[model samples]
Target: MKRLLTAALLTLSIAAPNAFAGDTRLELPLQDLIDSPQAKEAGIDGSVRFYLSGQAHPAVVSRMGEDVSNKKTNGVGKSDVESCRWVALSVLKAFQESAKARGANAVVDITSYFKKNEFKSPTNYECYAGNIMSGVALKGTYAKVK
Candidate 1:
């Protein structure tokens, strides 16, 4: 009986090696700051759409939503690099929310204001200022296009 049980277990393991593997979670960095061309081609909704340009559509009804900015003070022992990164993320988040509130699908013409020219990305309009405080600013344009 013991030999039979062992044989059965080994057979199952050999036949289905991945049977014990459940859904695994993997952490990965994502860059979704700009809307993909596929989204534009599919006529994606504005609520879930974001753009790095001033006008989402040239032939659609569009308006300047507003200018939004955010600032964060540096914490103790935090280097300027880290501080600017934190502030830029915070400000961009605020800008996105502000644009959504005003019915803007995307924020365009983004310019970064950073000390000593910090990290650069294809997306975002950032402003880094102040020794104690870092800041970012952006202008959003609300558009409704079919």
Candidate 2:
């Protein structure tokens, strides 16, 4: 019986190697997520503004440090875009709080830092959607801007 079960499992693995792989790459507009009402709900009221990669910002007064946020996916029955935005909101909120804590007024040079890979886009962000979850990762430089 054990041998038969092992043989069946082996066959299944061979038949569908990608059955459990769920990686959907999406690049969605960045401004929409930043402007969403949920940002207010997250307490990100523009006190600590964000500037995406290649976007212009006021002269940086001081560089506090780098910031990163890797939010877990909470996507169930939601579209990839919706799920991505929600996770991105949470990430940005954290950044805002961090900037505030460190006396920084902005986070600039934001980019997608998924899997430690940097994906920079001036107008969009990259998200990975899976079967049961989606994730948004961000990296930025904390700064006190003019």
Candidate 3:
């Protein structure tokens, strides 16, 4: 009976909803922001292109399989790299919106930040780990060539 109760409790815990369960919508420039008479008067009718990039330090530990030290382990886990990717995507979306707001047709010269750092768990576990930071940056000016 105890085993059954434990199983039931575990199931309930796993099924519980997360505090932040919904996917966030990407922020982009609205047509109204760029299609204003003021924007047209300001010579914002041209296309503007930009690029963005950034990086972040490793902030999580991922362990896979019985041999955490084995580099060839088939375990999959989260890392700072994943976080950076998300950040980059967000930045790119923002840039796109900004360009649109300025009446730019598109962006160019995009790049991303990249690096590797050593990481150790805070719990003082003598485990092997790596850190990575990623970034996105934009370069280009808005012009009214259109």
Clashing pairs counted in every model: 3, 0, 19
Would you list the rank order by TM-score, best first? 2, 1, 3
Local distance difference test values of all predictions, in order: 0.46, 0.86, 0.33
> Can you give the TM-score per candidate against the true fold?
0.45, 0.84, 0.29
Lowest lDDT sum, 10 consecutive residues, model 3, at 66-75
Which stretches in model 1 have alpha-carbon errors above 4 Å?
Answer: 1-61, 113-131, 144-146
lDDT (Cα, tens digit) per residue for candidate 3, span 50-142:
321122222213211110111111112534333333343344455545656655544432222122222222111111112222232223233
Deviation (Å) of 10 in candidate 3: 40
Clashing pairs in 2: none
TM-score winner between candidates 1 and 3: 1
Name the best candidate (by lDDT).
Answer: 2
In candidate 2, position 120 carries an lDDT of 95
Q: Which number leads on TM-score?
A: 2
**Across residues 37-129, which tens digit of lDDT does each residue of candidate 1 receive?**
433343333453344443233344565554646455453365544554555455556665676777766555443433323333344444443
Candidate 3 lands at a TM-score of 0.29
